[model samples]
Target chain A: MLYFILRRILMLVPVVIGLTVIMFAIARILPGDPVALAAGPNATPAEIEALSHEFGLDQPIWTQYFHYVGGLLHGDLGTSLLTRRPVAADIAAYLPATLELVCAAMLIAVAIGIPLGLATAVWRNRWPDYLSQVVAIGAISMPRFFLGLLLQLCFAMWLMWLPLGGRLPIIVIPPPTVTGFLTIDTLLAGDLHAFTMALRHLAMPAIAMSLSPLATIMRMMRASTIEVMGQDYVMTARALGLPRGKIILKYVARNAVSATLTVIGLYFGWLLGGTVLVETVFDWPGLGLYATKAIVSQDMMPVIGVALVIGLLFVLANLVIDLLYGVINPKVRYS
Target chain B: MTGPLLSIRDLHLTMTSFDGAAHVLNGIDLTVQRGEIWGLVGESGCGKSLTGLSISRLVPTPPATYRKGEIRFEGRDILKLPLREMQDLRGKRIGMIFQDPTTNLNPAYRVGEQLIDVALAAASHDPSVLGCPPGAGRRERRRAARRLAGEMLERVGIPDAGARLDNYPHEFSGGMRQRVLIAMALIGRPDLLIADEPTTALDVSVQAQILKLLKGTVADHDIGVILITHNLGVVAETCSHVAVMYAGNIVESGPVSNVIESPAHPYTRALMAAIPTKASKRGTLKGLGGTVPNLITPPPGCRFAPRCPLAIPACTAALPGAVDLGADHRAACIRLEALEHV
Candidate 1:
């Protein structure tokens, strides 16, 4: 097990390096100069040249890449042209909100998806199963941005409930920002009022973000559960006279979960990649919103920085899934 | 013979698929006595396994419809019982083992956990296992169940049984996994055991050892066994009574010696002849040359008529009824007189 862990950790080196190279190349190849964009459209040519020189954009692309890699090795993500702040610090500020939203969305997805999936398999071809299939397909096909807008319209505008967008009401001071996540910071500060307010603000955006992942998980789990029900071990469990609930929970789900795990992990990575439109629609402050702003303003530093972090996160998520496999199935550990 | 432990009368099972309904088991009648090992012998797709499944109510239902049957266990009509009651009876009163030891045990779980699950299930139905002082915690009950599981594994000849508690099913060899399954089935101390081709997935040498283990288990516990297999040799060695099935119908049945030594039905005779002996050279060995009839549209008469060497014009006229052949033996055939002459 230790050897497996060590090998996986070692594999991350090349993956990160490859990601850095791609990010560097893409930044260099994109149209419009970052320094020129930073100088603004009304700026004189001399001012643009001075700004370009200041940012070392006058150097060759290879030299700039080396500088980026060297700075990365030293734990520096450069400065965001938009905010005039350290790129890493800006990410640290914005990332937790995205993480909080994604985590809450995942929690909602798992809570509803697994039971619905199991029910569909248990009552296959029945009304409940058909209803779930229709709901899941609709959820999967419906655009998250559209869903977010509809939810805002119904729950916020028409019903006059729920804050339309954003992490917190402007009037309430967000608890100290200790954890950067409003939900956690408020809880840590023991402010029940702030926590409730944060959760209320989180509802629409999180639900919008969760629909696609929930549908994917349900569809994957339903197919796998149906298949696992026919396995020889399920029959053995039944023959053992295990009650229906125990049989489904212990034997059937235990075996079936592994088949859908890869998809779940991939969806988790998708959530982490940031649901750009969902974030845009809700205006919840996060990396997706941050990356979009950086891209539009032609701020290459934050764009590259966000891409690298998400890439690293994807690799780590896969590693975590591998570990999860060992926990769920002992056969994987020895083999 | 002692009172029958299990009896199935006029049990019929049909599987309906998109193509058509296949009459899989056409009025299967079988009786197993206490402490007797009854081998339900047949070729592949002969419905032997289905008969065993029906006894425990384990047959998957939608496609497999029980048309008409009465499976009586301890004088209770098992088919009429509610699903909840049937669940209590399964593994506690009637244990079952299936073919393919490779897949029969769940790979995700440790072999010991699976065994302990069976023990727990048994304990729930029969509170005698809760011998703990009143109000024993779950941990204590689990510990007791684990100890029983270890003992059961040892009884089935699994080496290092205690140390191997954490081992997954894949860690064990095919034969060892079979033994684990046997331990699981027997841990419940069921009154009847149904082993469906339990040794088919094992090595040639492992087959004999498993058979011996099953025989010893049945003899020691006084458990009636319905050993389903196509191997006549296994039946001769371990089973006391034998029922020969051909295409979902029991063509002949009797005490092992009577059935094996003098098979009355043409299909049984052909099955016996098909088994090669040292005296019979490989090239000269005879085989019943026709395939099993498709159950969807089976021939009008006896299922084996197409393959029976002794088949007559009247054989195809109708399905023959079981004809008594003295000494508790019976053969389903119209050519009984001809068999006597032979």
Candidate 2:
């Protein structure tokens, strides 16, 4: 397993390097100048040139790429043109909110999706199976932004059951950041009231973001489960008179869930970066919303930084999933 | 002195498919005595394996339905038993080993873990069936179960039984895997064991070893066995009694010697003729023409009438009843008198 993980990590170096080159080239080809946008339209030509030189945009593209790569090696992600703050520090502040939301949403997805999938597989072609299929399809096809608003309107405005989206209540003082995750930090600070408020605020957006991925997970799980139910080992398990629960959990689930795990990891990494529309609808302050703002203002550094972070996250997630194969399946040996 | 361990009376099974209903098992009667091995011989798709599966109710339903019959184990009606009791009966009172050893064991689990799972199931069954006290402590029970699994592997001739506990199913060779399967089936000390083509997926040398192991185990443990296979050679070597099946019906059955030497049914005679003996090795061995009839629309009367060389006009009218040939020998055929006289 150590060898597998090491090889995976070693393979990632070239990939990350390749991604950096693409991000750099893509950012440059976009029809906007961050230096010009920062200098303002009314600024003198000399002042514009000065700002460009300061930002290293005046240098050749390759020279700029080398300079940026050198800073990146030391963990500096350059400065945001809009905020003028270090991009890495900015990402750190915004990432935790997105992390919390995506984690909660993924939790919701796995918790509901797996059982739904199992039931559908067992009761295949029955009314319940058809009903669940319709629900899964609806969830997958429904637009995330529209779903977000609909949830907000129902739960907050009409039912008055949950809070409108935000990280926490403005009137309440947030707990000091230890992990930067609001829910965990609040609990760590012994602020139960704040934690409860955080959960209520998180409810709407999390549900909105979870639906599509939940459908995807359920579909994958259902397919894998149905495929496994026909396997000879399951027949052997049944022939052995293994209790239904053990047969489903041990023999069937272990084999069936491996395929679902890969999808879950992929969706989780995607959720980290792809919650742009969901974040905007809920007015939730996270990396998605931050990236949106950065792109609009032509802040190339932060946008590039977000892409690099998200790409790295995707690769790491897939690596972790590959490692999980050895854990779930005894046949999968690291060597 | 004692009644047969298992008796099937006029067992009929039909399978419903998209095309039509298939009469897969046609009024079959079979009895297996304790401390005896019964071989069910037939070509592929003859429903021999299905019959074995039906005994334990392991055949998949939705497609399969029992038309009429009573399966009696120890004089209690198995068909009448509730599903939960039936589940308890499987692997505790009755165990089954399937044809393909490559697929029968769960690939993701270590052989020992699967064995322990069976041991655990056996341990939880009624104490009388288990033949021991339920034992004390969960930890002690688990350890005991593990030890028993190791012992069973050793019994089946797997080398380094204790050390091989952690090996996955894929690690074992085909023959070794079959041994693991045999070990699993017999580990519960089941009253009856059903082995479906247990040696078909193995090489010739391994096939002999498995047959020997099965013969020894049945004899030593006094457990009844229903060994389903297509090989007449295997049946003749290991079985005490043989039932020759054709198109879902047992055409002829008796003591192995009687069935082999004085086979009453034409299908049985044809099957024997197809085998390559030392005398017939250089010559063109006789082959049975025509395929096993499609069960969905099987010809009326004896399923084998179309393929039977000795088939008479009356054979096509209705299925024949089992004719008494004496000494526990019987054959289902319309021309029993004519054939006997000849």
My TM-score estimates for the predictions, one after another, are 0.96, 0.96
* Every model's DockQ: 0.75, 0.65
Which pairs of residues collide in candidate 1?
Answer: none
Interface RMSD of each: 0.9, 1.1
- Write down the DockQ of candidate 2: 0.65
Please tell me how candidate 1 rates in CAPRI terms: medium
Q: List the residue pairs that clash in candidate 2.
A: none
**Evaluated against the true chain A, what TM-score does chain A of model 2 have?**
0.96
Model 2 residue A24 CA deviation in Å: 2.6
List, residue by residue over B146-187, the lDDT tens digit for candidate 2: 888999999999999998988999999999999999999888
Query: lDDT tens digits, residues A1-335, model 2?
Result: 67777887788678768877987887788897777888788988899899888888888888978888899999999998778899999999998888889989999999999878887887899999898899999999999999999998999999999987789878999999998888899999999999999988888999999999999999998999999999887887787778888888788887888879989999989888888999998989999999999998888889888888888888888887877877887677688
- lDDT by residue (B94-138, candidate 1, tens digit) is 999999999989899888898888888888888565465547788
After superposition, candidate 1 runs with Cα above 4 Å error: B129-139, B282-285
lDDT tens digits by residue: candidate 1, A50-152: 8787777788988988898889888889888768799999988888988888888988898888878888999999999899889999999998899999999
lDDT of 1 at B154: 92
Q: Please give, for every candidate in the order listed, the TM-score of chain B alone compared with the true chain B.
A: 0.96, 0.96
